[model samples]
Target: MIQSDTIHGIYGTEAAAPPKSQPMHLSMLPCDLKRHWGRCGITANFLATSTEIPSPAAASIISTVINEILENSVKYSAIDTKPIDVELSIRNNTVECEVKNWARLEDATIIDSYFKIIHDKDIEDLYFLQLEKTATDSNNASQIGLLGVMHDYPVTLGCRIQTTADPITPFQISVKAKIYLNEVTP
Candidate 1:
């Protein structure tokens, strides 16, 4: 089924964007911490231009968003050797960005629950609540980038967190951002 907007599912369900028969840009970034950050911009630039988004502003917006996603993928990746998979595709009036990475089961549970709490209606409320939670956390970390992406941008978010029965096996997190083409163009 072609999902219209929000996508959230655990195992045994298709919790991803409608498959892109042929993605415009597909990249596999090996978990090279030193190099991954620099490569995100280069790849995002290619995605914006090669995808031919038309409006310069929209292109810039899309590129920035993709770069952010890439950065998050690098941060959350569980294993050093596993590669992060990113796909860019155009579907009807939306441009979709999907990033898949391996995550520790603990991290997967937290992120999955976070997604579940955010529905179409109360995202703003949850956004601020999350802000406080992250701020007070022991790591002194922040995930506001994602909350801002979900709140500030004209995009629909989807996620599929694939789990395994074996406790030793790492889980997979697939995050998708679907930006409406029409909302983006001025």
Candidate 2:
């Protein structure tokens, strides 16, 4: 079982508790991540308008991050009634994008394994390995999404799985990707 402490660490120190002044601002985009909804193309459109990320490269990175997470959410989600949640916010000069969705109980373990790659491996090695796999016609193409975000973009990635109150989907998967504004080209 994935521990709460591990999840907390993935979200960074600030996310451990809410700020005393104001809550973390979350703006939900119009796009539905549960369905393909036109792949990255459509998601990028909404993501572009969601925040003034300033850097064009940063905007592209944010869009790609969202696209990858949304794809995973839709592919893994067990319940369609529960809408996939996408939140974009700016905190302490960093742009944070979070995507939440429900996954089957049995499939929840995948989150832990994915994060293992994040904590254990070097991003560059993983990226090249994934590229090599793709070149070899490997069936596990979906695994590269997170790796691409970590290797190609200047962002930090995190994920966690928790039990929700909903009986239909008692487990929820939340993935977060954060990029510093200063890292992006203005």
Candidate 3:
């Protein structure tokens, strides 16, 4: 488990410090969620015991969301020998998970379409409908896992895909998500 104090110290020395008034959390990328569930379980227990929050649901949601985000990074973004970067933080009753990869942007159209479809209607209904469509459609290659996250979790989810220009590599993609806990329920 990464502590808030350590995160504060690391970001403090940088040129521009991140906002520090909010509660935050952090974790390093694990080998795999199955292999590290034990660690997550312990972390959840500690957080539940230490915080004023009564429910352990937030911790469970964080673990699952991070696992899915990391899995996506490993499967989609780790293409050119670049290590996946995962960061978790909380601010103003919200939890943010960000994953960065050193891969060129691919199929931006498909990603845009996915977002469009997801945004057009209620997330829960859209997610279930998409799952059914994916199961029935033979031509669909897009992963349904993301929709699953939206369906299973009540938190408002946002995704951003960013591109950067580097002299040598030319491009890199960053995927970020912020899950608000205040609206999520156990």
Candidate 4:
């Protein structure tokens, strides 16, 4: 059986400070992963309208980050039995986005590596360059997608992954990212 604790953590707490500006909420069937992309676009629009900073660059980065994380959930998560959950919130000038899904224990290691690469500032650029050089390599496409997001949003890209496993249990992967609008574009 799959544990539900991880899901609870992702959606559990209410924000300490509600967004001074309007909040946007979106949810859809994970059957069409394209809806995830659409949600990202909506997030970008929210960021652009709410923040004082010019949003062209920030919007692009935000959209890419959301899509990359959502795409991972859609691709690696168990189908039918488990649907991906994504939530986005902007509060106190920071945007927090999380995506969670069910998986096997072994998959947690892969999720760890993804976070390590995404959070490493020095290596992220090099990693992206390598990915670009090998863009035609199908096997590495997913890694490239992640690298692209890290490269574009290096300053405000903070990511975390949590997992738990036990006998006869399904593992869970939850990815969270926070982007500080003031720090990124100011």
TM-score on alpha carbons, each prediction: 0.77, 0.79, 0.61, 0.63
How much lDDT does candidate 1 score? Answer: 0.71
Model 3 lDDT-worst window of ten: 1-10
Q: After superposition, how far is residue 18 of candidate 1 from its true place, in Å?
A: 8.7
Ten-residue stretch with the least lDDT total in model 2: 18-27
lDDT of 3 by residue, 1-186 (tens): 211111111122323335334433544344443356465445434433443342577767766666565555555543434455655555656555666554443533344456557656777788777677878888545476566777777544444444445444333434455556776687
Residue by residue across 136-166, what tens digits does model 4's lDDT show? 5666444666555555664344333444454
Clashes of each: 0, 0, 0, 0
Query: Which of candidates 1 and 4 is the stronger one according to lDDT?
Result: 1
**Which predicted model would earn the best lDDT?**
1
The Cα local distance difference test for each model comes to: 0.71, 0.68, 0.52, 0.57
Segments in model 1 whose C-alpha atoms lie over 4 Å from true places? 1-21, 33-36, 132-140, 164-169
Give the Å shift of residue 57 in candidate 3.
Answer: 1.6
Name the weakest run of 10 consecutive residues (lDDT summed) in model 1. 1-10
Tens digit of lDDT per residue, candidate 2, span 57-156?
7677677777787777777777666667777666665677688877766667777677886678787888898788887885864578878877877778
Give the candidates in order of TM-score, highest first: 2, 1, 4, 3
Ranked candidates, highest lDDT first: 1, 2, 4, 3
Q: Model 4: which residue pairs collide?
A: none
